[model samples]
Target: MNPWVRLMSKNVANICIMLILPLVFIIIWFYLAKSIDNTVILPSPAMVLQLLSHPSENLISMGSLTNNIFISLLRVLAGYILAVMLAIPLGILMGYYAKIFQLFNTFVGLFRPIPPLAWVPLVLAWFGISSFATLTGVERGILFIYLNNIKLSMVFIIFIGAFYPVLTSAIYGVKNVKKTLIDSARVLGASESDIFFKILIPAAKPSIVNGMRIGLGVAWMCLVSAEMLPGSLSGIGYLITHAYTIARTDVVIAGMISIGVVGALMDTLFRIFEEKKFKWQRLIR
Candidate 1:
C-alpha cells in the first residue's frame, strides 16, 4: 500500500473508532436520565437536543444561541491572540538570552501555578462597575449601565489563563534547538536575524503548535469562567448561568455541549494546519 494512502485509511479508522466512545456515552446518558426520574438534575439527551433545535426560542433573553457563541468566540480569540503576540516574542527572548530568562524565571515560576479563576475577583474589581463608570464618566450605582464594557475584563482574564502555557512551551522549544545548529549557522556566517528566524523558529514549530493547542483550551476555559461572573450578559457561560437560574437544565447542558463541540472543531482546524505546516518533519522522521 502507498504510504500516504495507508496513513489516510488509518486516520479514518481511528476517527471511526474514537466516535464509538461518544456514542456509548450518549447511550449511558440516556439510560441514566430515564432512571433518575428528575429532569432538573439530569436532562435527557433528547431534551437537550430539543432545546438545541430551537436555540433562538430557548435562549431569546440572552440573544440567540448563535449570538452567545459568537460573543464567547470573540473573547477567546481576542485573549488568545493577545497572549500569543506577547508570549512568542518574550519566550524567544527568554530562551535565547540568558539574562532575559533569569529576569522572568522567578516571576513565571511563582505565578504560573495560580488558577485563572483566582484572578477573577481582581479582574472584576479592576475592570468592573466602578472602572467602567469611571472611564465612561457614568455615575456610579447605575445598574446594568456598565455591564457591556466589562468584556475587556473577561478578555484579560482569558489572556492571563493562556499566556504562561505558550510562553513556557515556546521558551522550551527555542532552548531545545541543538546548540550545534546555532553554532553551525553562525559558522556559516548567517546573520543573527537569519539564524533566529530561519533556523530556530522552524525547528521549534512543533513545540510552539503544542503550546498553542494547550493555550487555546485554557483560554476557552477562562472565557467561560469570566463570563459566568457578575456583569456578563452574553456568551455561552452567561447563557448557561441564565439557564440554570431559570431551572432550564436542558439549555445548560446544550450550552456545555456547544462549548465542547466548538472547542473540538477549533482544535481540529489547528491540528490540520500544524500537520500541513510541518509535513516535512514527518518525512524526516
Candidate 2:
C-alpha cells in the first residue's frame, strides 16, 4: 500500500474509535429521556443539542452560552497564569536547593490537602467583592465592567486549585534530572546560570509542560465552583445555576457541554505541543 493511503486509513480508524463512546452515550441518553419523560430530570439529547447549535442565542436571560463560556475562560486564565508564574520559579528553586525545599515543603504540604473551595470563607473575608476594577480604580466604562467581572476571591480559588500540581511537577522534574549531568556541566566549566537555564530547565521542560497542562484543566474545573460563589453574575457555572433554578435542564446541559468542549480543546493543544516538542522524551520511555 502507498504511504499516503496507509496514513489516511489510520486517521479514519482513529476518528471512528474516538467517536464510538459519544455516539453510544447519546443513544443511551435519548432512551433514558424518552423512558423517564422528564425534561427537568434528564433532558433529551436533541434539546441540549438544539441549545448548543444556537450558542449565540440568549438563554434564561443569563447571556448566550458562548459569552458565559468566554467569561469563565477569562477567570480561569487569570488564576492559572498567576499560578504558573509563581509555582514554576518557586518549584525550580526548591527542587534545585535542599534548604529552600526544606524551608517551604512543610508550608506547602500544610495547604496542599485543602480543597480550593474550602478557602471560600477566608477568601471572601479578605477580598470580599473587590475585583480588578477596584484595585485599578476603574469606576466606569467597558474596561471597568470587564475588570469588575474578575473578582479577587474567584481568582484566588482558581490559583489554589492550579498551583500545587504545577509546583509538584516542577520540583519532581528538576530533582530527578541525572546527577551525572550536573557534575558533567560543572566539569565543563558551566556557570550556575548556564547549568540552570541550559541544562536543568531544558531537560525538565517536558515535565513542566505536562504539569501546566494538568494545572489548566484543574483551573477550568475550579471556575464553575468559583463562579457559583457570591458576587458572580455571569459565566458557565452561573449560567448552569440560573438554568437549574428556572427548571431549564436543556440550557444547563448545554452549558456543561460547552465547558467540556472548551476544556478538551485546551487539553488537545497541550498534547500537540508535548508531542511536537518532547518527542524524544516519549521515545526514551
Candidate 3:
C-alpha cells in the first residue's frame, strides 16, 4: 500500500467522523422544529440557513454580515497583535532573568484567576459611554468614528484577555530550554543576544505557537463579550444580542454559527502553519 494513499484515506475517514455529529444535530433540530411547532424556542436548521443567506436584511440593523464579521476580525487581530508584541519580549525577559520573574510573578498570579469579562464594567466606566459622534471630531472621518472609545475599550479588554496565556507560555518555553544548551553556547563564546536569538527562541517556537493558539481563542471570546456591551453597535455578538431582544431565534443562531465557523477556520489555519513550520517538532516528538 502506498503511504500517501494511506494518509489520504485516514484523513478522509477523520473528516467523515468529524462531520457525523453536526449532521445528527441538524437532523434532530429539524425534527424538533416540526414536532414542537415553536420557531421561537427552536428554529429549524433551514430557518437559520435562510437568515444566513439574507444576512444583510436580517441581522438586526447591524450592516451586512460581512461588515460585522470584518469588524470583529479587526478588533480581535488588533488586540491579539498588541498582546503578542508585549507578551513575548516581556515573557522572555521574565524567563531569562530570575529577578524579573520574581518582581512580576505576584501581579501575574493575582490577575490570572480573573476572567476577562469581569473587567467589562470597569472598562466601560473608564472609557465613558458617549456616542461616537459626540466623542470624536467629524474631520476624523469614518475610520476614526468606528474606532471610538467604545471600540478602543473593547480592544483593551481583548488585550488583557489574551495577554496571560501567551506571556505564561513564553515564560515556560524559555525556562524549559536546557541549561546545558545555554552553557554550551556560552562556552563557545556566544554573546547573550546570540544565545537568545539562535538557541532559546528556536527551541521555544512550538511553545510560542501553542500560546498563540490559546490566546487567539480567548481573544475571540473577549471580542464577543465586548461587542455585546450596551454601547456596541456592530459585530456578530451585537447581532446576537439584538436578535435575541427582538425574539429572532434564527438570527441569533446564525450569528452564533458564524462566530463558531470563523473561530474554527482561524484555528485550522494556525494548525496548518504550525504543522508546516514546525515539522521538526513533530519528528522529535
Off by over 4 Å in 3: 1-11, 55-58, 129-140
Candidate of highest lDDT: 2
| Model 2 ranges off by over 4 Å | none
Q: Candidate 3 — worst ten consecutive residues by lDDT sum? A: 130-139
Residues 146-221, model 3: lDDT tens digits: 6653366778788998999999999999999999999999999999999989999999888888999999999998
lDDT of 3 at 201: 95
Model 2 compared with the native: what TM-score? 0.98
Best by TM-score: 2
Candidate 1 lDDT over 69-166, as tens digits, reads 87788778878999999998999889889999999999999999998888878878876633234445556463324334347678888899989989
**Alpha-carbon local distance difference test for all models:** 0.85, 0.94, 0.85
Candidate 2, residues 22-89: lDDT per residue as tens digits? 99999999999999999999999999989989989988888888888888888999999999999999
lDDT of 1 at 68: 83
Evaluate residue 219 in candidate 2 and report its C-alpha lDDT on the 0 to 100 scale.
96
Model 1 stretches astray by more than 4 angstroms: 1-15, 58-60, 130-150
Residue clash pairs of candidate 1: none
Which TM-score value belongs to model 1?
0.87
lDDT, model 3 = 0.85
State which candidate, 1 or 3, has the greater TM-score: 3
